[model samples]
Target chain A: MTAQAVISASDLSLTFTTADGPVFALQDINLTVKDGDFVSLIGPSGCGKTTLLRVIADLERASAGTVSVNGMAPEQARKARAYGYVFQAPALYPWRTVEQNVGLPLEIMGTADAAARVKRNLDLVNLGGFEKKFPWQLSGGMQQRVSIARALAVEPKLLLMDEPFGALDEIVRDKLNQQLLELWAATKKTVVFVTHSIPEAVFLSTRIVVMSPRPGRIIDVIETNLPRDRTLDIRETGAFLKIAQRVREGLKAGHSYED
Target chain B: MPVTVVCLAILVAWYIAAVFMNTVVAEAKIEAAGGGLVNTLDISWSLERPVIPAPHQVVVEVWKTVFTVAPWKVKSLVFHVWVTLSSTLLGFALGTLLGIGLAVAIVHSKLLNKSLMPWIIASQTIPILAIAPMVIVVLGSVGLTGIFPKSIISMYLCFFPVTIGMVKGLTSPDPMQLDLMRTYNASGPQVLWKLRFPAAMPFLFTSLKIAIAIALTGAIVGELPTGAQAGIGSRMLAGSYYGQTIQIWAALVAASAVAASLVYGVGGIERVVNARMGVRA
Candidate 1:
């Protein structure tokens, strides 16, 4: 009767011990992501949004409380290859061609049908005939797309993206945002995206988790009531503006606007 | 074009230096022969035994010894070059493999990193020239003559740079890249083969260039003090004993040529590897 929880966290905390002091990178984080749900962790810089994503991916350890991915411990889920993560940068190996870059995980895992999977994923990202081109030959946006293709090739159950389009120009960001929405709609894969842009969070996410810095905790969670097949045109609509305004208010309440 | 100009400038300077050095000897000989009229350049450049032979004299000597004799004959510079080259190649191959192996071990094991790196640095400070003869004599007493003993000395001199370079290379991948491999549940060897080794290619090639040059130096030095019957080192030694400055200079030129060719050969291999790995030019 209830949707299965793809990711669940309760009172999660992470402290990075630095030379100055113990930096509270994340604290008192509680959230639940359901199957097929698109959640955006929205925040300004130092908001622990990326830290939370890293915690779920088991790349960072929580100093307190517990988190489960697919009802298993984060480490266990990671060892099971339960998720695919797209970092802020493309992180494509410069020495590998586009096709080889996408196929890296498949080769490492020794999966059969690797060539077919690489082709299918590249096509899924609409990168069809640039297989032999090196990453350096592509533009930054294109390189990021290849990174996305790399993640999708693994066919992981969950997707974790950290500011995947943070460095792109506005026009390219808009285009990628639209392509990503369409991708989400087609695959129905659960995504937890981290971003600083309010409109981007509103445009792509079914739910937005607004966050603040000092101790790096959530400030608000706004559920966007928009059409499932949304378009960039929705950013001009009253419904989209209403959600965006609320996200702005939540961010303001956390004082993210101050220099 | 600039390189050619600099090289020509250096050759002119060398010629001037040889003339200045041999002028006193040439003047004294002319005076002893009752002050006969002879060109100063000819007398200095064509001396029976000058301090530093003119570049042309060294070239002429090399041409005569290399082109005018059977390559297998001891009198041929080609024979001496072959004797030195065999040891250099053998030492370089062994040194490279040993360096890479040590680097991998030091990288994967903290104990080795702590215990081995300082010693490797210390090993280089002992002066290869001091150790070369000791190594040759020790190995020779155990009847390990020929190329193997010389190669061991070459290996000793060359492995330091390669080990240091490869250690840096293997660890060059940033933390984020390493984490990506971890998320895939990739095995250790998979991470190393797919990520670390490929990542270390540029460093490996750089180290190989330096190691090849050092390996040749090591081979030549190993030939010294042992009075080895062949090789460029022995040729130079015999030339010095007989006060044949032209012969010594010719052997020195041949040694430099060998070093340059070896470095360029490594560079050629580097280019092919970079192309195969899709590195942008």
Candidate 2:
């Protein structure tokens, strides 16, 4: 069966006015994310990958072009509470315990049985037994996991993550990437991830969207032909290396094209 | 710990010196020949009546004034304490309301922040003592009596710290946390109640403790003029007029204890609220 498009962006552009002049953060960005698809946006610094993610999440507005999520405008989708977003840092409320932080969105959405939902989400993120712990008491990776648990507690149809594991060490990043994939597989939720690491993008994504800076725009979209059942062993396979190499070449091309 | 111990040691020494000074003054008075003749040779730092009375003398006078004296009597310590406490509590409540209201307004409005911030800061520069008597006279002529004048004085002293603390707390959210909330399409009010208010709590508690102390000072200052019927300040004025040094010292001690207790109460409440929020630290 053909996959249904969950998010569609057409000719999206975002510009911000600064003291220097008007700067284009993203330009002519077009992409479609299929339901249950794992897509990664990768680029160099100032390439507007995070900006594109923010626009799609409706945290930031686009200067031009139209974007739709779940057949609704980004703002409408956001109001409907159809997306879960994880930021670069954990962003957990320092004052709240892990359970309460996780339960925050549910509380805001006015969902009943918040406690049960919080417990379930904590379990999903493998943060069980840490419900009473405060954010500052947790390690960096644990804090990020708490944030993920918070987002998932609301059970949004789409998950948007902006460099969620970028602050973690390689060991933790690898582990979290695998866990994220496992989470996606189990929940069958569409994911739009942003990262600067080529290996991370190739390892986690079903499709990689490479972008260029200095007026950010998409340069290429490369699909992974690897099998759906992936594990730590998959990263060492020739197929994975080939896809990672292709992503690197696309990034190099992106750099030269911008120049 | 060492600093506190040193402070206590110094207070004990001061108390002993006050008692010795009183004895020396009394002995010199007995040695004088004429009924009103001054003893010039016994000039060993002994005044006819010491400005700072002995601690035990103050305690005995306080006990007599509080228990033996009638409410209508001019020397009743209990009456004075009641007056002061009433004014302090009223002023504290008003100041708390004003501070919280201003903080909320400043946090929510960019235009108000730009315009009113400088004015709020400027208001504190005018000393509260200078403003107190004027406030009393103006309010008195307008037929406002009792608590209103005193409460205004307390409010003047109490609001500044609270506003500063609350403003800082409200704006303390991290960039990532803010973006996360925005992505959820959280409304302004939702963000405030769920995020800013909780974050501002520790700061609010800190400000409240400070405000309470200022409120006590305001109440004492408010009593200094217009001959307050009851209050520690009024007691101090009466003591000065009659050379009743012990009465004044007792009132001062009472005020200090009350202030300390009020601050301690707020601290207790802070701990409970923080625990409920899972912010035990």
Candidate 3:
């Protein structure tokens, strides 16, 4: 049987009204993510990559066209808790402990055995022992990890991430990327991720959607043939370099202006 | 350190002012009694009715009224303090609740925010002193005398700060945080209880401190119109009528002490809440 599409966006457009004029944040975007696919939307700043992710999460409205999650309206999917989203910032509640923060979604959903679910998710992110600490007390990277645990505790079929490690240092980001790849392999959940890093998209995504600004729209969709169970050392390999070169070329062809 | 030095400097200044202010009266009495200026300083500090009583004289009056007199007696400052504090606390509690209630409604309803906020801000421009008498008289006619009338006046004065502070606090959460709650598909009340209310703690405690202080002032002013016979305000009123400047000074000192203590008390609670919330001192 063919894998079912987890997310579908068709000719979607979003314009923000400003004092100067209407700003087209996203325009004529079409995309599809099949089950268990790790898809990354990569582009320069103002590319509306994050905006597109927000629309899929129903955090922002599309000015025109249609988008659906699990064949449900974005709003319906949101109310159904069909997906777990990790924002760029950790966005942890400062007043709550690590364990409580992880369990926030479950508490809201009023699910049974919440403590067990919280524990399982924390372990999944390798943050099992830091449950009692406050988010502020943890390092920035650790705080972000806790946020991932919080999202995973939702136990949704689809994960949406928006530059979840954009603010971290290179060393921490590399470590987190490796852990996230391992996490995706184990969970086998579909992911819709946004980022501006070429190497990050190449290393993490099964399909990379390259986009550009000035009424943000997709320019290329690169399907990678790299093995799923690969490590960071693959970035030094010729095949990995070829894919990364292609992504950089795609950005240049679209006048990405990243530099 | 600097605080102690400032306090000592203020006391010295107060004593010097007392001597200078009472010089005319003390000189007149000494000359009329055929006494010389040799004991004028002592006499000035111990005047029957000094324009400004000496610091020691005010302290002595407070000691005599508070410690020596039985607490429940009309002559005791403790009794007057209790009378004033009870109404101040009651009014503060009511005012805090009213302010929070209004703030919640205003934050949630755009219509209420646009319709109510301007009127609330305008209400403060009308002097509380002007409104207190009418409030007291109106309540008194309805058989709500004593503490209730005085408390209504205090509530009127204090609720303004609480409302403004709470409105700012309830809306204090960052846009991203609010968006996070929205992504959860959280209901309105759920968002308030889990996010907005917790975020507003620091602001609420700050407003409570200001509200409590204003409530004290309101209660004192309330005593004038309600003819409250037992409160510290009444003691000051009675002192003014008889020109007992020492008594008035003692009551003023007591009122200030109570205000400081109440603000300090609210700050203590704030510290505890902050610590529990994992905020570093």
Q: Candidate 3 chain B, which ten residues in sequence have the lowest lDDT sum?
A: B30-39
TM-scores of chain B, in order: 0.96, 0.86, 0.97
Question: Which stretches of candidate 2 lie above 4 Å from their native place?
Answer: A256-259, B1-4, B12-48, B63-74, B141-143
Model 1: how far residue A160 lies from native, Å = 0.5
Output per-candidate TM-scores for chain A, rounded to 2 decimals: 0.98, 0.97, 0.98
Q: Write the per-residue lDDT of candidate 3 for residues B186-258, one digit (tens) a residue.
A: 8898899999999999899989999999999999999875567899899999999999999999999999999
Per residue, candidate 1 scores C-alpha lDDT tens digits across B1-281 of: 99999999999999888878988878877566565435667777789799989888898999999999999999999999999999999999999999999999999999999999899999999988888888888988999999999999999988989999999999999887898898898898898998999999999999999999999999999888789999999999999999999999999999999999999999999999999998878
Candidate 2 local distance difference test against the native? 0.86
For model 2 the TM-score comes to 0.91
| Superposed Cα deviation of residue B181, candidate 1 (Å) | 0.7
- Candidate 1 lDDT by residue in tens digits, A1-259: 5889999999999999999999898999999999988999998788899999999999999999899999999999999889999999998888899999999998987889999999998998889999999998999999999999899988987999999999999999999999999999999899999999989999999899999997899889988868889888989999999999999999889974446
lDDT of 2 by residue, A74-185 (tens): 9999889899999898888887889989988887888999999999989998999999888888999999999998889889979999999999999999999899989998
Q: Which of candidates 1 and 2 reaches a greater DockQ? A: 1
- Backbone clashes in candidate 1 total 0
Individual DockQ of the candidates? 0.79, 0.69, 0.76
Instruction: Give the better candidate number (2 or 3) by lDDT.
Output: 3
Return the candidate ranking by DockQ, descending: 1, 3, 2
